[model samples]
Target: MSIAGQIAASCQRAIGITLARMMSRRQFGQTLFEHQALRLRMADLQARVDLLRYALHGIAEQGRLELRTAAAVKVTAARLGEEVISECMHIFGGAGYLVDETTLGKWWRDMKLARVGGGTDEVLWELVAAGMTPDHDGYAAVVGASKA
Candidate 1:
């Protein structure tokens, strides 16, 4: 596979593992809020998110985050994969085009399938730009949501 594919695949694996860890039922009570000593953790997490939202304040951050999110991950994976595979294909360009596994053709094929799996990079960039500004009344919404 090409460098793009290799990078994307590695990132996918790492992200998958992290999400898996978060979703595991056994890890439920391990949540930071579950402990009295770390009762402040919830606030800390919120602060962190708020900071992240701010840090990613412009189009650049938004675009990058959008690309990495669940919505666009597959697409990114495929694109990067294709880039890498294409280069690899170039190394053995003529022969690689016809084969499957060893030729690293699967990388580009998978990426092609994934590119349209969900939102396109352009759409995500727009979405994120739209999402940049925080809701001024968000704290109230959080309070109301918590009560329910």
Candidate 2:
């Protein structure tokens, strides 16, 4: 799997862990998942994860990964993974800080490494943006569209 795919998978695992933790960990007389704010956050994370997975599937179906596509995916996956994992850590509160009690801390640290691994976000963004011209249509090119 590409680094982007690995990061996306990691984010999915973090989401699953967070969901399981929320369902079992109670606060204010109810499980953490019972809170409206936490529910909303979970929804947002789910949506983003779905989008990333969809993109990966599309790339797989194409049987080819363009440079722009890989760069965009890497940049997006790194940023989103970091944000999602960090949010999961926040949801875990102090327990997230303890490696023995929860794996959020480890996931958070691993995600940081992803951001720097394939290439920095700035470099990847430049590669993506360089192809995003009126004629080039970077998104279409990545998705293998014949025309923009």
Candidate 3:
């Protein structure tokens, strides 16, 4: 999860840099970053990045976390990374899709891999659910006994 958060932060910084470059060119009589819509989107993305950072910090401060909490963090971080990269790509226009044109393409690929590289978002969700269940121990015991 920390890794995912770090990746997201890096992607956000890259997007900021790209937006700054675009703003300098004065596309269509105004910079894309100067538009209210883009500004709002960027704000939202920043909030998400901050939220992920906060979550990570809180977990670290606690010195320990349950499986469900860890899973939740992982899921949130992975999703945030995906969202950040996608938005960055949108800001980059068609050039975002070309690896030779922009690093956003590589970031996008890395985010996709992050989503599936671990236990996967779906598997993590299931782990969270199983851990949250009140009968988790009993259920595990039943399954274990059956395996014997």
Candidate 1, residues 62-87, lDDT tens digits: the string is: 56444334333333444554554454
lDDT of 1: 0.45
Structural similarity to truth (TM-score) of each candidate: 0.37, 0.87, 0.80
* RMSD versus native structure for model 2: 6.4
- Candidate 1 C-alpha error for residue 49, in Å: 26
Q: Whole-model Cα lDDT per candidate?
A: 0.45, 0.88, 0.79
For 1-148, candidate 3 gives per-residue lDDT tens digits of 5665666577667668667765775667898878888878878888888877787888888999888887888877888888888887887688888999888888888888878777699999998888874778998999999999
List the pairs of residues colliding in candidate 3. Answer: none
Report the backbone clash tally of model 1: 7
Q: After superposition, how far is residue 18 of candidate 2 from its true place, in Å?
A: 1.0
Rank candidates, TM-score, best first: 2, 3, 1
What's the candidate order when arranged by decreasing lDDT?
2, 3, 1
What are the runs in model 2 whose C-alpha is more than 4 Å off?
135-148
lDDT, model 2, position 99:
87
